[model samples]
Target: MPNALPWLDAAPVLAACAAVAGFLRPRRGTAEVFLVGAGPGDPDLLTVAAVKALGRADVVLYDALVGPGILDLAPKSALRVFVGKRSGAHAMAQEAISALIAARAAAGKVVVRLKGGDPMMFGRAGEEIDHLKARGIPVTVIPGITAALGCAASAGVSLTRRGVAATVHFVTAHRCDAGATPDWSRLADPEGTLCVYMGKEQASAVRGGLLAGGLDPATPVLAIENGTRPDERRVSGPLSALPDLTAALGGGPALIIIGWAVAGAEASSPVSAALAG
Candidate 1:
């Protein structure tokens, strides 16, 4: 009789063990999001952290400029969504993209927002971060190569040289608010290299600003389209010829580098010679 019900005596111990296990269990409803940089236009340039994040992503939100072959790193099961915006075409609005990211993350899925170039550099990461934080979603950012660095490397041009270019300034010709523009006068530093992002359509404004700011129109300038890609094109000339150079290329992502340091590239090379002035 004593043995028949003896197992019941351990109920308290078992209950305590259950309580400990419950305490150790992971909490539910937590959100996780990764803001990852896909580099300029080279899949090989992806950082290890970026690769890992993409591999484990349950959903990936990508930009228009993300390099080819980069998305292949993600698992086949991951949902790939294009959230990029071209000059005049937007696949998804900023607010809608943010809402979608937060919604996917809230469902307890691993979310990766894959962006072109560095997330913090003109990528509108702040707006997304703010949206996610307000909804209690945790965010992690992994940096990648910016367009200026990638374009310079592919063109064999140095953005900053020992004596020629002591500093480098990164500016964007496109603004979120239409009609608003960068202060080109402040950016026309003689000793610093100027890297213009999204300046293809605004090439004339860029040239005018630098010239008016007293930057020598003869300063060496290099325009790279589809930088670091197989179809990449390079045009090098004086600042006075920037607009024409930009116009010569097909509609593609482009970066404009202006400074004496650009002279480091072989302007006589076949790819750039015809446009080199």
Candidate 2:
């Protein structure tokens, strides 16, 4: 006849349930999609706007390069989907990823397409943007530090130094079409810094192209692996040694910096020291 559940005992259970409910509450936002840059590998490099967008994300579709620390910024209730692509293995095709984004947004969800590095730089964000725009979905973009800048800063290398590197160029070693190559002659500026992304596998090609294009073989080159992250490693040497230097780095997202500005930049480990010798 008396109350089966006492207030004190039931109070704790009810409070726990409330907390869970609050944590799992669905969020709605004005923008249907947010294209956020995760900023290399370091979570500290994430922009303020990027953080805010991630916080309010109802669904986050992230790439392989987006670290776990960055993804943890999203709400616990948000759906985190992996649509990342590595060299030979792709979790989801680009077309499928684009379609999923539109479908999620059309369902009235706040979708965040989280990319590593500045979304505009080699991130394929334009493709996603075009897809969303064609569907009339409102989207917002938040930029973050690109890998080149982050790696250069970590290595204490000034991409552009007075009387040295007058210009800077960012290029990718991998092309969408096989057997296609970038204009090496145009990129071989004596007074310019060249940063090559996704060049780990194509190190030999890069070295050969630059050499054939008449870039000074004695030019300094620095390869920073896992740049801006805790385990960051830097290897500095001549442009002729780019292939060996890159090979010593093992498997990791690396940025190859070529210019006089990176000549004397500090190397964290003996890999660079060995290469330099």
Candidate 3:
């Protein structure tokens, strides 16, 4: 979660098996499956471990968030399938997606499930893992740079800074179909940071809850849209101004960093000079 040694957290998260690697050694008798993270939107953000897996893929099941220039890593003959919402709208459901993976692996093919962010972080990887395990498929997981860390460094925003913020919480602002949304009052910490993922659709709810939870209306909020890529942009203002900020952002995927750590800070990446302008 800290800026330094960011990959330390990536070492052992939801991943327990050795990776299927590059052209050095040919894949063995048993074909393995890989669940890998593509990282925010930058191909460079991919880890060495993930790259090796991609090289060995027989068939890659990729999501909508995967950026351009990434699929080139796969072997030329490998089959690339787009299995995301944007591709089919609602035609391809999660169950069908899992079944597709199972069918391919059952045929003894090397499968790589390439998701946008870290597979474990709200990528629905757990369901896929469960499905694979039930069908006796071999699977490996590889972690990638989450959008929060990628955007923070690229945009010059620190989620956690010494003497400014010590604790950082990653919460989802997704509009849930069932159950209550996040408890904002319990999540607010003056000395801490809040990184909201998939938050643009519900920015108003986030703003209202934080204000009602005792966070100052003047508390700073910084949002990095299309983070880490060349077209990245930024917007920042007091918490009360989230609605306008959310409405103004392009249709690209975005994340929000909330707390004093980002207050009045100019973006380091080539982002908007000011929230208003």
Off by over 4 Å in 1: 1-29, 267-272
Model 3, span 147-222: residue lDDT tens: 8888888877778889989999998876335545898878878889999988887788889888888898877888
lDDT by residue for model 2 (177-260), tens: 888878766788878999999998988888888888899998899999899988888888888888899888867799999988
Report how far residue 68 has shifted in candidate 1, in Å: 0.9
| Clash tally, candidates in order | 0, 0, 0
Per-model lDDT: 0.87, 0.86, 0.81
Deviation in Å, model 2, residue 221 alpha carbon: 0.6
Candidate 2 overall Cα lDDT vs. reference? 0.86
Model 1, range 1-277, lDDT digits (tens) per residue? 4588755788789998887555333345557789999999889999877887887788999999998999999999999999899988999999999999999999988889999999999999999999999988889898999999999988887888898899999999999898999988778899999999999899999999889899998898888888888888877888888888788777889998999988846532354556553
Model 2, runs deviating above 4 Å: 1-31
Error of 1 at 75 (Å): 0.7
